[model samples]
Target: MTDENNKIRVLLVDDHPLVLDGIRSRLEDDPEIAIVGEAGNGEEALQIATQRKPDIVLMDINMPVLNGIEAAEKFAELLPDIRLLMLTMHDSREYITKVLKAGAKGYILKDVSSSEMLIAIKAVYQGKTYYSSGVTDILVNESSKKEVPLTDREKTILQLLAEGNSNKHVARELDISVRTVETHRRNIKRKLEVKTSAGLVKYAIENGIVEL
Candidate 1:
């Protein structure tokens, strides 16, 4: 849908300068794509996006100040027609699911070939979804498993535990008894099939319930 004067505008967001350079180099010469702007973090991304209002945003998941998932939520609210395409190193089901829920239209790995990356960009710009092989594999694998849903309380406790909060700290924050927190923790372990606190923390981080 590129006329001689009109092209698809894209904003690139990533914490690393080298990664931004690589993406810029890949898409700079394209006839139908315009490199409108770039941001090093999600907070900067929001500012640039609000000012530039690009048609698509290629963003990384992990960034300082603000994560891409949270930024994607704001982007959805600020720019309804803007397409959010995730370009990240994370290939877990949790990250993908969270990004999609946060209003991302596509997810692709950072290691993909330039051709595949371009294809993903074009697809998402054209109102379609795209996912890298690694992302699709994680989704398929998770779908094949017997997924266990966590309750709201368990999720809260898990997030607190992952953030290095003690039982007493969690109890105080939630206004619940320490014994109740312990019970939730035990139940979380049993439901998640994790034996130790470390395992619980790892699970929580990997599943997008909490960040490292």
Candidate 2:
């Protein structure tokens, strides 16, 4: 649990051992932050997260088993209380937008200074979102762009619901809370403007949101 005292619990996830070592060396001395665990990929990160329950996950983009954005989607479903912060080398607007939509609460480039990193960690730990200066500019520019109707995760849940899977079944398959599944169902309904299970099926079939 991130609750082992009042210190902020953090998990460091990156494929490069050097990167992990660097972050560990830097943050390990901070009394306010506890490095709960480390993972080399998204799958391992998820496993460790279940065991450690970090309050914030500092993740990278590229990984072997599962990428960070996809993992962020899963984290959004499974651990809605935890915050995600992407610290990667990717600075393109496209990457930034995708990670934000994937449920990252903050994005900071790898080149960020250690001081700023500390500030960002503290900020998100306190329930405030943080983005590095360059990322802030990208966010401002992307603020007006409209996103697609449903995220990949939402479409997956929609497919399950349309396939006659109950919320409990969907939650079990997705490894998420039933309440989280219900929240997604409500959002899928509102986004697709459908009020019934039949309506969801029809929309899924018509829009090809599901393979059927």
Q: On residues 1-212, what C-alpha lDDT tens digit does candidate 2 reach at each position?
A: 34457889999999999999998888877778999999999999999999989999999999999999899989988987788889999988778767766777678999998888888888778765567888766545444534449999998998887655779999999999999999999999899776655456545544655443
Compute the lDDT for candidate 1: 0.82
Question: Please, what is the TM-score per model?
Answer: 0.66, 0.66
- In candidate 2, position 184 carries an lDDT of 96
- Candidate 2 segments exceeding 4 Å error: 1-4, 141-212
Worst 10 residues of 2 by lDDT: 139-148
For residues 161-190, could you state the per-residue lDDT of candidate 1 as single tens digits? 766577999999999999999999999989
